[model samples]
Target chain A: EDQVTQSPEALRLQEGESSSLNCSYTVSGLRGLFWYRQDPGKGPEFLFTLYSAGEEKEKERLKATLTKKESFLHITAPKPEDSATYLCAVRRWDGSEKLVFGKGTKLTVNP
Target chain B: DVKVTQSSRYLVKRTGEKVFLECVQDMDHENMFWYRQDPGLGLRLIYFSYDVKMKEKGDIPEGYSVSREKKERFSLILESASTNQTSMYLCASIPRGLNEKLFFGSGTQLSVL
Candidate 1:
């Protein structure tokens, strides 16, 4: 079975504060790992797709890093507009083409 | 731009009543998926279709069903709405290929009373 776990269910950060959200996953074979940002009452917006360990991607204040067993979303100097739920999902090589997602970490950036 | 569109943005329903959520994609993708999101439960796949008239049960399929009569459209049906069924339903579509990501609709916030 494939599983994804995100740590720190909720995060509150002051503007300019930096922190990282953790996503631990277990899968038979990893095909891709994805990160998304979802606002309240809205669908998730795709952020990054990391395909292999030791890979990293960045966008503005958000940076994502991937390892064999886990992934991390690091938010640097976050702003109020950056407040949203961070979602991590993994697609395995099972041929199902389905993504298994973690519960998510709700980030609140207070200005 | 590629888009996935859900028919409704908000809905209120009565228990035991049948409900339908429609989704359409302009990306001409062969795969479409239905998922329900809840606070602490993340996104659980309810159903998915890979082609016209083909459907597959996902992680959570109880009390729910799906239809895909066209390649660009998928529909999710709740035979009998229940209080526990209140949730934000999301629709996603992905093109067939490696490294392709899903495009999601804005979502429908359904409240079953």
Candidate 2:
């Protein structure tokens, strides 16, 4: 079974505080890893796509890095508006074309 | 920007009633999907369509069916709504590749009473 697990189910950070969210996965063949930001009562918004290990992507205060077994989403000096649930998903090469997602890390940035 | 839209943001239906959740994407994506999210289970794929009239069963497709008459539209049908089926239904679209990122809609919160 392809499984994805995210750490720190709930996180609280003061404004300008930096933290990292973890996503660990076990799959047969990793096609891609994705990060999404979802607000309360809304759907997830696409953030980044990591294809291979050692790959990294950045957007504003958010930076994502991928490794062989896990991925990290680093939030630098986050603001209140950046508070949302961070979801990590992996798509395997099983031809199912389905993405297996983690439970997500709910971040609360207090300003 | 890629836009995925669902028919409703909130819906209330009784148990055993038939339900339909519609999703449409503005981008000409070849792949469209339907997922249900609960409080703890996260997001689980229910069904997906790779092409027009071509559908596939996802991880949790037991009580659901799908329709794809066009490239940009995918519909999810619940034959009989149940309390356990009350969840936030999400729709997504992606290009024709294994490594593509998905574009998601605002989601529909369905409450089964």
Candidate 3:
């Protein structure tokens, strides 16, 4: 079975603190890995998509790196406005276009 | 920017009542999906449509139905609402390719009493 797991269910950090969130997966083939940021009571916003191992993408203060078995979302000097739940989703080899998502890591960057 | 919009942000329905949640995407995406999100379960796919009038059952399609009357619109229907059915329903769309990233709506928070 294809599964995605996220570590550190919750993270609390002061403003300007930097950290990384992990997303590990077990699947036959990895089509793509997706990162999303979801605010409380709102839908998730698309962040980045990493297709191959050793691929990395960055947007503003967030950087995503991917490997064969895991992906990391690194936040640089996060602020309170950056506080939200970060989600990781994976597409498997089935071409079904369906995604298997992790439980998400709730991040709080207190200012 | 890709824009996905849902008909409602918050909804309250009673048990046994039929409910409808509508979603529209400005982007001409080939794939559209409906998902329900819970606290710990993350987002579970309920239904998806590849083209107009072409719908498929997703991972959790029981008690739910979907309609894709047009290329840019998708709707999710709850035949009979139940308390357990209360959840945050999200809609997303992606372009024609496999690697096209999904764009999501603001979501609808539904409460079944």
Candidate 4:
């Protein structure tokens, strides 16, 4: 069974504070990992896609790194506008594009 | 930019009533998906279509059905709405290829009374 787990269900950070969110997974064959930001009452917005271990992607203050068993989303000096739920998902290599998603981490950045 | 649009942002329906949630994507993507979001459960796939008239049951499809009559439109149907079925429904699309990144709609918040 493929499973994705995200830690720190909720986090509160002061302005300019940096922190990391974790996503651990167990899958038969890894295909790709995805990160998304979702605001209250809205759908998730695409962030990054990590295809292999040792891969990293960045956008503004957000940096995502991937490993064999886990992934990390590092937020640097976050602002109030950066507050949102971070979602992690994985796609298997079994010719299926279906994604398994974690519960997500709700981040609150107070300015 | 790829755009996925959901018809309604909020809906109120009574129990035992049938409900429809529509989604449309402008990216000409071949794959479309419907998911439900709940607290502590994240997002769970309800149904998906890879091509017009082709539908696949997802993780939680017991009380739901889907229709893909056209390439760019996907609709999720609730045969009989229930209180437990109240949730935030999301729609997403992805182009068929190695790029499995999905573009999501604004979502529909359905309330069953």
Pairs clashing in candidate 3? none
The order of the candidates by DockQ, greatest first, is 2, 4, 1, 3
Runs off by more than 4 Å, candidate 1: none
Chain B global fold similarity (TM-score) for predicted model 2 against the true chain B: 0.96
lDDT against the true structure, per candidate, is: 0.93, 0.93, 0.92, 0.94
DockQ of model 3 vs. true complex: 0.68
lDDT of candidate 2 over A4-106, digit per residue (tens): 9999999999999999999999999899999999999999988999999999999999999999999999999999999999999999887656789999999
Residue A32 accuracy (lDDT) in model 4: 95
- Residues B1-113 of candidate 2 have per-residue lDDT tens digits of 99999999999999999999999999899899999999878999999888899998888999899999989899999999999999999999888764677888999999999
Pairs of residues at least 3 apart in sequence or in different chains that clash in candidate 4: none
lDDT of 4 by residue, A1-101 (tens): 88999999999999999999999999998889999999999999889999999999999999999999999999999999999999999998765577889
Q: Please give, for residues A1-111, the per-residue lDDT of candidate 1 as tens digits.
A: 888999999999999999999999999989999999999989999999999999999999999999999999999999999999999999988666678889999999999
> For each candidate, what TM-score against the reference?
0.98, 0.96, 0.95, 0.97
lDDT of 3 by residue, A28-111 (tens): 899999999999999898899999999999999999999999999999999999999999999977766777789999999999
Worst ten in a row by lDDT for model 2 chain B: B94-103
Provide backbone clash counts, one per model. Answer: 0, 0, 0, 0
Give the fraction of native contacts in model 3.
Answer: 0.57
> What is chain B's TM-score across the candidates, in the order shown?
0.97, 0.96, 0.97, 0.97
Which is the winner by DockQ between candidate 1 and candidate 3? 1
